[model samples]
Each structure stands twice: as structure tokens, then as C-alpha cells.
Target: MNFAKILRACKGMQWQLSREYAFKSDLKIKWVRPEKIPCTKPEKSGDLGKLPPVNEKEFLLDYKDSRELQSADPIVQSLFQLGNNRCADTARYLREQLIKEVQRHPLDYGSMEAKLARMTVRIRIMQDELEQYPRNTKLKVALKELIDKRKKFLKYLRRWDYRRFEWMLEKLDLVYKPPPAEFHWITRKESLQKLTDAHCEKIKEERLAEYRNMLDEQKIPFLEDAIKKMEFVRKEQIDLEIPVSVTEEQIKDFKRELEALKSKREVKVDSKK
Candidate 1:
């Protein structure tokens, strides 16, 4: 036969053999096309380059200076009356007291003592007013603000001069409680330690789980065989020349004998040297 005819005969024979094998075998061959995964669009970046302008009213509400409170608020005049009895006109007396406390060479309004005194007076007046007008939300808010301001001053005083701070608290009849030690900010060391501990714990749990799974996956017969060997060793099979069940006393004695043998061997080696 020609080469092309011979090739056709071989191919036909192979096809027949494949059909016969498919009919006989229980196994079936299948071709599956993979499903396509959908792609998601990337999120657009926000315009973070330009920040919004700060609201002046909101800023003043939170961080108003004592001087700002002086002429603008009648509450300051009332606060002054509660703390002092020097002058009949509360506003004038308040101004005079502030100036005296300041004792600035240039008579500037930015004085630590004067600010603290103002905040103390405000806190006392607010507390009294709040007791009277318990239902007033505005009064309650104002009182909370005054208390916060006073606490800030107290913090400064405690840091700068504890003796002066105590004296001031006594003079004002103010109860001062220090802020909590825990702050919003975290130190690098603390952050690293926390992360390290968490990572180590996670890794340890994962490793333990993996080891447990590995032990579980071992064939039952393999485990049975190992247990049998251990049991045989524990029983001290005479034919195997293995020791019987080892007691605490026997283990201790064995350890001592091993140590003595080690020492004697070392001595013999030294003598040879």
C-alpha cells in the first residue's frame, strides 16, 4: 500500500479503538469553557486640593478670648459680681480686676492670670444660672463651654505651677479634675507593639489550625499503627527488648545513670588525651 493509504488505515484503526474504550470505561471526558469575569470601573478621585474656608462664627463660638467676652456679653458683668464685691458697677469692677491680675507692662489684654480668672468667674456664674434655669438648653451649652475653658486654664496652670494652680482653685472654689491619661494620639512604639502582638497571635492561630488539619488528614490506619507502637513500647515487650511502663522513679534513675555514663566517658576521653 501507498504511504497516504497506510496513514488513513492507521487513523481509522485508532478511532475504532478509542470508541471501544469509551464504551467500556465508566469515566467520561468533558470540555468546559471558562466563564468570563466582569471588570469594574475605577473610582474617580475627589477634589481634595482646595479646602473650604473656615466659618468665623463657628471658630469664635469655640475659641472666644476673655477680651471678646468682656464688652459684648452682659453675662460677663453678672459673672464679675459673683466673684468680687469691690465696686457697685460690676462691669467697671470686672475690667479693673482683669487689669490688676494682668499686671502687664504694656497693659495688654493677653494675660494668663486674667484669662483664668475670667474663665473661673464665668464657670461659677454659669453653674448658678444653670441650677436656676435647668430647662434652658442655651444656658446648659454655655455652662459646658465655660467649664471646658476653665479646665483648659487649669491644665495650663497645673503644668506651669502646681502651687499656684492649687491656690487659684481654692480661691475660686473650683473643683479641678485632671484630664484622662489616654489621648487620641498613639505613639510609634505603642502602635508597633500592638500591630506586632496582633500579627503574632494571628500567625500562631493559623499555624496551630494548619498543624491540626495536617494531623486530621493523616490516614486512620497510620495513626492506629503509631498508637500500637507506642503502646507496645510502654508495655515493654520482652521480644522487642523495649522497657515496660516507665514510672517517675525509674525515669529519674535512668537519667542519673545516663549522666554518670556521660561523666565517665568524658573522664576516660580526658585520660586518653
Candidate 2:
């Protein structure tokens, strides 16, 4: 196997076996075949970075910014109410503790205050997660696309970072790993696959050409002999005649059986006489 050619074929395009030699020029001239390549209308570019990564903080902000949900979605609002209740309960508990501490003659409760502060932040994070679930999903998609466009750049950087002395050792076989979720357009998938398919097709065509050449040079005589034997068998089958070229063992066995039968017949004739 030609490793470089195989890798290129696997990564870049679809592959198919072809008998014709015109494919040699096709590889140089096209990234994808015209028929296999999908025609797509250009999408209007939008500011992508405006969409932040899908985290708790980003989710909350996205929900707050949405036109339909300025007041917040009912489900998110319910979570927010539950979070607020928890906060009130915690604050009330702290206040009671503070009162008890004062009663016990305490003016310093740094540890208790810190605990309440931490509790408040945790509650807020939970609230954000509940409110921003949908917005987070949308932003995640946008962020994923941003990451995809930069993937080649990222791969190059990784290779560069890993490079020690030998450049070949640092080379990584990077494959496109799209987000493990749905996309707005299936055509994007089709296009990516088209490029992949074209590459595969080139490799297959090359390999098939190689195989046919090998068969002609090395294996065709054996195949021809098998074909001739099949033809001879077919002729014998149609004629119901014994083959002229029998194996030596088969001929010997047949001659032995015939001689035994002839001797038996001669004995019967002698007895009748």
C-alpha cells in the first residue's frame, strides 16, 4: 500500500474503482467531481464570536438577551423562583445565626459570612443553568462552528508543539470531528462527505488499476488454465463422452475393472462350449 496516497484518499475524497486511465488527470484538476460535488448557495456571514461558549454564566446572559424571553421562559422562571426561595431560606438561617451570635456577645463571624457568600454563588450558578438551557444550546452550536473553522489551525499548532527533532514524527493524522449534535443544514455534511468521497474514489481508481496490472502480469495464466479446464468439463458434460485426458490413477482403475469383466465373460463362453 502507498501510505501517503491511501491517507490522502481516505481523508480528502470519495473513491471508486475505474477501468479507464483518464482518472490520472482528474486527480490533478479537481478537488471534487462536478457531478458528486453539491451546489450550495452562499450563506450570509454573521459575527460568530458574539456567541460565547455554552457555560453557566454565558447561558444566563443569552437567556437575558433573547427577544422572546426578556421576561424569561416559564420553566426557567420556575427554576429562578426555586433558587430565590433557597437563597431566602439560607439568608434567613444566617440572620438567625447572626442574632444568636450577637446574643452570645459576638461581633466577629467571618467564617459564617463566608459560608453564606459561597452558598449564594452556588445558588446563582444553578439558576443560570436552568434559565439558559435553550440559549446555551444555540450558543453551543455557534461556538462549535467557530471551533470547526479553526480546527486546521489548532491541528497545525499541536503538530508544531509536539515537534522535537524529526518533523515526520510530529505529524498527526487529524480528522474532522464535528460536534456530536444536529446542525441547521444537512448540505454542510454532504459537502464535507463529497470531498471525502472524491479522495476515496481517487485511491480506489489507482488501486484497481494496480490490481488489474498485477493480474495481467502474474495471475492471468493461472486464471486462463482454470477457464480452459472449465471449458473442457463443459464439453464433456454436453457430449457424455469420456475425456481424452484422464488422470493416470483413474485410467489404471478403469483398465483393471474392464479386464476383470472380460475374464469373467471368457470363462462363461468356455463353459458354454
Candidate 3:
């Protein structure tokens, strides 16, 4: 291995450690997640092509190179095109479309937008290649580097001129995600804890709803008993000529509420059936 490669590796390790410490210390700034967090997310965006890396519409050689001849005779098509280097032709076409308006001059290829456009073409092609041969580590590494480089360019563009950055994103249909202030590992323990908490929350909500239904059921029976008892007491009070505090209006209201609840419960039961 090259000494420079080892040195770079050491630096990378040190950087990761510092980031991890920042995460563990819990003083990092809160980043507003651009998208909802799914139950499972990759360790990093680049690995496994998880970047959700900008969507690119492939430029087809059939359209760019031989659009007029596509509807022409088979003999004419065969004579006009050999059907080789189509991938390269498509990449060139896409690159031109991306950089045509953004380039500083006709000869400009090193501008930020120009480089980004070129990288985007390469990234798109490589991702396509990866789809066929997922075990190609070399291609995967190159693709990851290309993706990371594009991200860096986008980040710089965002800071330098946010308006241009927005325009660039719109043009490329790319989502620019800022580096997270804190990096937390998705450990088994942490994932299980989150899932367990979610499961418990669901169960708690279900149980609470059931408890509420039970209380509701009790209300009808309780109201029936209370009405019977109250009517008996009122009869006795009238017979003894005693003063009454339980008003007829109060009993009527209770009965009305009880009827409404009983009707609602019956509707639910009928629906279930």
C-alpha cells in the first residue's frame, strides 16, 4: 500500500472518532430531517447506492444519435449506425444538456457547474453498471467517490450562492442533504429499543381504547340502575311529603344521553357484524 494511502486512512479514522465523540457528547446542532426517517436506513448514503443520489433521465442513443432514422427503414438504420459505443454517445449527450447553459464559455470544462454536470453523467452511468454487477467493488468505489464529489460541489454552491444552488438542484433534480451534525451508529440495541417503544405505544393506545369502551358499556347499566333507584326514592319522598333535591330535568337529561350512547353502540355492533 502507498504511504499516502495509509496516511489518508489514519486521517479518516481520526475524523470519524471525533465525529463519534461529538455524537456521544450530545451537543451537536439539530438538523431538520429533509425526509422522514424510515425504519431502516443505511450506515451512510453512498454505501449500497443509498444516497437516493439524484435521479437522472438517461439520454438514449436511439434518440440523440439516430432519432431521424429510428422510424426509417431497417436497411437505412443498419447502414447509418453500427450500434456500438452507444453508452459513451449517451453520456456525451447528457453531459452537453447539463452544461450547455451553465458553462462559462464554449471551452469551459472546469467550472463548478461544468464539473458537476460531468460528474452527474458519470455517476448515472456507473450506477446503471452497478445495477448489473453489484459485486464490482472497484466500480462501486468510483461511483461513491463521484457521488461524494458531487455532494461537496453542491454544498459549496449552496453556501456560495443559495439561489444558484437552488437552480442547479432544480435543473439536475438533485436533493442536497447537508452533513449531519451528529453521526449515530444504528446498533442492534438502539434499533430494538426504538421498535420496542413503538410496539409498546401501539399496545398502550389499543388498551386505552378498550378501557374507554368498557367504561362506556358500564355507563348504560349504571344509568338504568340509578333511574330505577331515583324513581323509587321520589315515590317514597312524595308519600312522606319530604323535600326533593333530585330534579326531574336532571333525570331526563341523563336518560337522553343514555339513549344516544346506546344507539351509537348498537350502530357499531351492526357495522361489525
Candidate 4:
């Protein structure tokens, strides 16, 4: 609401109050009522009414710059944008409250510092939400998380600097949507899938080369040859029996043996020729 509109509304309210009191003129009025009917005068000449116009270009440019902000989930981005105005106002209010709290209880440095940090982070998140998707659903969720997280973080700072908060908000400008086309152009799932596929292919190629080297060097025909080459053979194929009385400790010892085998053994037979 602009200053002029607010004054006009107040005047209308006053007229209504006067009418109501006139009906109850029997009551001894303590204060002097208005002599003439309530009417709003023309707004003062220098009082430029209403908020200054938003700088769409500068705003959009800031929106273009935020890479981290743009990386937000689309749903979340939208929500933030949707709730921007309220989020902005709320953040300012919360920060102001925190400031007052800090001033009121200066000696309680621990609690005051905490609240300051919390309010700062909250303000940052709210500012980000407002910048990106003012009034968006994503903004709402971000705002909530931001509030909760910042509140938890605030338990540390002794003094507050709102400029820091504003700078952080400016850094967040890129979060808003409709974001510049570059961010929205690529789908996360698709990009991840592409990366994973490439990684798998690379690993498969490496494994294939390793196996090929193993086969070529050892002249092993198949996996069975590889396994047989790794086995130790005794002269008479002596039947050695494991102690059936193997205790739990013995089993653990044997388990470590297998692990060592896995680390050190690679079946490679020397060519007879």
C-alpha cells in the first residue's frame, strides 16, 4: 500500500468511527471529536508515492548469473519464485527481530550469537527463495529448510551483519525462474546417465585389456586353466585333511588367509616353450 492510499483509508476509517460515536452521543466524550467531516487532502508534493519500479534488466541479469541457484530442483525453484515477496518481507522481519533480541540480551552471548547466525542463514535462504521463485512451492520448502537450518546455525555468531546477508542473497539471484535457458536446457537424470554410462564403458575397457594381458602372457585357454595354474600340486596328490576340530579362532585365521590370497594371487602360467 502507498502512503496516499494508506492516509485515505485512515481518513475513511475515522469518518466511520465518528458516525458510530455520533449515534452514541449520550456517552460523555473524553476527547474533542472532529469539527468538520473527515476528508483526505492532496498528497504532499515531494512524497513520491508507491515503491520504486523494479529494475527488470538488472534483476534478470542477476538471475542469469547464479549457477548454484539455477541448479536447484525445478519444483523448488518455482516455489521460491512464487513466495518471493512474502519471503523477502518475512526475512527482513525475522532479522530485525533477531537484532533486537541480540541487543536486548547482550550478555547472553552464546544464545545471542546462535540466534544471529540462524537469522542470517534464514535471511539468506529467504532472500534466495524470493530472488528465484518468489511465491513458488520450491521456495516454500527451501524457505522452511532455510529457516530451520539457519536457526540451528545461528547458535554461534556474537554479532550480526546484515550486509553479509544481502551479499549472500545477491549471490543467490540465479535461483529464480523462469531461469535463463542454459540451466533448464539439461536434465539431471540424463546427464548423470550419460556420465555413468561413460564410466562403465571405461571400466569395462580396462578390465578387458587386463584379462587379455593375463590370457596372452600365461597362454591360458580359459578360466579353468587360470584357476588350475593358481593351485599348488603335491607330488603324490597327498590327501591332506583339514582338522574337523577347527575352532572359531581357526576359522577366523583361515578367513584372513583367503583375504591375503585374493590380494596377492594372480594365475599366470609360464609357457612350456
Candidate 5:
């Protein structure tokens, strides 16, 4: 029985290891919903073969290529020609610029720094276009997506090469705001505390207002009467005519008088109503 139990434990450990490996491997493939797919859907359901096969190279090429074609510049015109299978000129220009900035020899298209540079340029272009056409939602969404991608790249670069991450940000003239370290609990607590304080303040204000209105209805000089009573108490203390206990008694008497006045005003208002 003990031998069987040990074997079962070993099998469980092995299964856990295999599950982790599968999860890690699955993360390499970018997941996308059908609606959020970056490419256009084929017109015919059976024309799947006509669509280009999804591959890393093709995906990177599509991202590096610009969608604009109305530019008078020759380079822009060449990069955005319709029905082009690839954006050779645009990719070459980006590669040359990134290679010079990194001060490295020719690196693969999949290099992190190279990808970061491409995303930065694309985001900058999209922002310029957005400034020109403020109502273009498509450009805004594309810019947001590009910023998210750049943030991920920044995280990766910061982990691997801290100096390189700083360098990239400076070179691109980008501002990197790190995400908050705390979870949702801190934010929720702060929001709840603010709401509670506001509620208590509102209740306090309403009660004070009601108290003032009650005083006004009674036609009693509440503020002036309190001030006079306080002044009389202070004068007695300075003259050594009354002790502290006597001053306290005077305050209590004043409070009793106000309560009686308020009750009488309430009865009169109720009878009138």
C-alpha cells in the first residue's frame, strides 16, 4: 500500500510539470478574437486558402507596413501600394534606422529592440494623423494598441537590459509610466473611505442647517445669546466673583433655555400647520 501511494505522488508531480510546460508553450502563439482580428475577413467562407497563412514573418511585415497611400512622397507611395504582397521598402528603412540606433550589426527582424523601434515610429505616425483628423476613431484605437505593445516591450527590455530600456525611451522621446504595484484592494479602500467621509460631511451639514432653521423659526437670538453668556462667564472669572463650577452651571442653564425655546417653537409651528 505504501509503495502504491509513493507511485501515485510521483505521477501527480509529473502531470503538474507537463501542464506547466504546455501552458508556457501555448503563450508563444498570440491569441485573437474573431472580431478583433487585425485583418479583413475573406468574402467567401470557403476561401480560407486564399488568405495568407498566419506566420511570424508575415505578421511582423503587416505591422511594419503603413496603411496610408495618399502621400505625395515617393517613399510613402512605394510603401503603401495596394495589392503588394510585402512592404520591402518600409521594412528596410525601419531596419536601417533601428540598426543605427542600437549600434549593433544586422539583427533578426524578431529582435526586441528592432520591434520596439518599429512600434515607436508607427505610434508617432498614428499620433500625427490623429492630430490632423481628430475625429478618426480608427487612428485612435490603433495608437492605443501600439502604445500597449510598446509598454510590453518596455517591460521585457527593463527586465533583460535596464540601461537599454532607458536608452530606448530617451531615443524615442517616449514617457514611460510604470503600472501601480498594488492590487485592486488599495483603490477600493480609498474610494470607500472617500465616499464615507463625504456622506458623513453631508449629514453633518444637513443637521447644522436644520438646527439653524429651527433657531430662526423660534425668533431666538441663539448666536448673540451664546456669545453674551460666554462673555459674562469670562467677566465673572476675571473679576473672581464666580468659580469654575459656577461658570459650568451657567452654560448648562443656557443650554436648557435653548431646548425649552426650541420645543415651544415646534409646538407653535405644528399648531399653525
Candidate 6:
């Protein structure tokens, strides 16, 4: 054969493949996928603290501070409180409350507390929306990005002004969960393989225990049969006036072991009953 023929003969050698080239696990087991963490916290009450009072729900605009519609006309006030409070209205109210004490001036929006307060309000609103409509992907993405931005701001605040950072966290009732040093993804194959190994080990232990019990069950019967055989041989030898291989001490030892095994079996049976 020429070199071309030899190459053609070796081309279809699929049977010569080694398992090292492919990712394969010896164990086969099923494992449920872990649930992914959500960007918005629906379970939480809110990051901006508790809800506003029932009576003041409609009048989201600040009546005391802004002096909005300064005249004390009951009809105008009733008109202002006509509709129910929207999320934006609530967020605006909460933002003003958070920034009222911390602001250096009426327009100190650049301050650390003011920035955190804004982010917190938006976060709370988004979380509520997410709870109502969980499948809103665009909102989910926006919330995640906003959360990351807030984390960065919080970290900066912590590094520069730690006292204010502590105050901000307490005021917002927010937990700062820092990102891990490294991120790892969960793979089904690896997880199932680990579970399979553990399952095999458990099965091994169970089967070995059963085999031990089987061996133990046969111990008394084997001892009795051996004692009988030894006695019969000793009797036959004695009748023929020959030397005996089985001694009285050996027979006594077998009888003692048989009695002990029988007592143990009886105890196990009684315990089961």
C-alpha cells in the first residue's frame, strides 16, 4: 500500500478514541438546578422604609414645606387630593423626607445622602413594579444596573465619609451585599456527577451492610454443621481405634460461638417485634 492508502485506512479509527479527550462522568445522577437570585427584592417591604399614612396617601405633594397652593381653600385642597398617589408621587415624597435633614441647602442634590436617597426611592418603586409584573425584562435590567450604580456610590461614601455611610444605611434600612472576590457558574454535569458519586457511596455502604448481615445469619448454621461433622469423624475414628483430629476443646469453642450467635439473633428478633 502507498502512503495515501495508509492515511485513508487510519482516518476512520473512531474506536481508538480515549475518554480523556471528551468530558464524561462515570456516575449518572439527577440534580435540580439552583434558583438564580433576582435583581429586585419583591419579598422586602421597601428600601425607602415604611409606606406613607393612609390619610396622606393622596396628598403626596409637600403642603408644609413647598407652600404649594398657599391659600387654605378646602375646594382646591380637595382638588389636589382628587386622585390616588402614584409610585412616582410616593417616591418624590420619600426622597424629600430623606433629603430634608441631610441637605445643606434646598438644592443640595449633589450630596451623598441626597444621591443615596434618590437611588433608594427608585429602587423601592422598581421592586414594587417587579412584584406586580415579574416578567418585565427591561425593568429588571434597569433595576440591576441601578443597584450596581448605588453599590458603587455606597462604597465611595463608605470610603470617604464612613459616619454618613452608616447613617445612610440605617435611614434607608438597606443591606449592603458586596460582590465576591471571584464568580463561579453552576454547571449541571458537574453537579450531577458529584451527586452521583455520593449516591454510589451510599449504595455501596448499604449493600455491604446487607452482605455482612447475610454472613452473620449463616454463622450459627455453619458452626453447627461443622461441629456435627467433627463429632462424627471423631466417633468413627474412635470406633476404628484411630487418632482423632477434632479435640473436645475445639468442639466446646464452636458450641460457645454458636450459643452467642443464637442469643444475638434472638435479641435482634425481639427488638424488631
- Per-prediction TM-score: 0.30, 0.17, 0.57, 0.20, 0.34, 0.51
User: For residues 108-139, could you state the per-residue lDDT of candidate 3 as single tens digits?
Assistant: 98988888777866776777687788788898
Encode model 2's per-residue lDDT on 1-273: one tens digit a residue.
899999989765544444223564564534443344211101111111111122222223224456655466777654433243454444444343333422323544444233333333333333335345635655445444443444444445445654421222122212223344665544654765576688889899999987875654454355455545655665676678665454545545545555555565578679989
TM-score of 1: 0.30
lDDT of each: 0.54, 0.44, 0.70, 0.45, 0.60, 0.75
User: In terms of TM-score, which candidate is stronger, 1 or 6?
Assistant: 6
TM-score head-to-head 3 vs 5, winner: 3
Model 4 Cα lDDT, one tens digit per residue, 1-273? 799999999999999999976854643323333254211111211111222233222212235467765787876555434234343544444444444443436455355443543445354544544556655666656555654444334322212655544433343221111214565445555665566567668889999989976654444234334334333332123336543333445445545655544443453232322
Report the C-alpha lDDT of model 5 over 1-273, residue by residue, as the tens digit: 599999999999999999987964654433332343221112211111221122322223344455453334766454444234344444444545554675445555567776776666565555546658878878777776667767787888899999988887776655666667975533544655565567668889999988987766655576447847686767778789656534656676777776776787788789989
Backbone steric clashes in candidate 4, count:
29
**On residues 75-122, what C-alpha lDDT tens digit does candidate 1 reach at each position?**
544443333333223333344454465344556556666676665444
Backbone clash pairs in model 3 (N, Cα, C under 3 Å; residues 3+ apart or in different chains), count: 0
Q: Which candidate number would show the highest lDDT if scored against the true structure?
A: 6
- Full-model lDDT, candidate 4: 0.45
Ranking by TM-score: 3, 6, 5, 1, 4, 2
Report lDDT (Cα) of residue 252, candidate 6.
96
Runs in model 1 deviating more than 4 A are: 1-109, 182-273
Q: Score candidate 6 by lDDT.
A: 0.75
By TM-score, who's the top model here? 3
lDDT of 3: 0.70
Q: What lDDT tens digits, residue by residue, belong to model 6 across residues 49-137?
A: 64444355256465543465556576666655525545566567767776776676998999878887787777777877887898999
Clash count per candidate: 0, 16, 0, 29, 0, 0
Which regions of candidate 5 are displaced past 4 Å?
1-95, 182-273
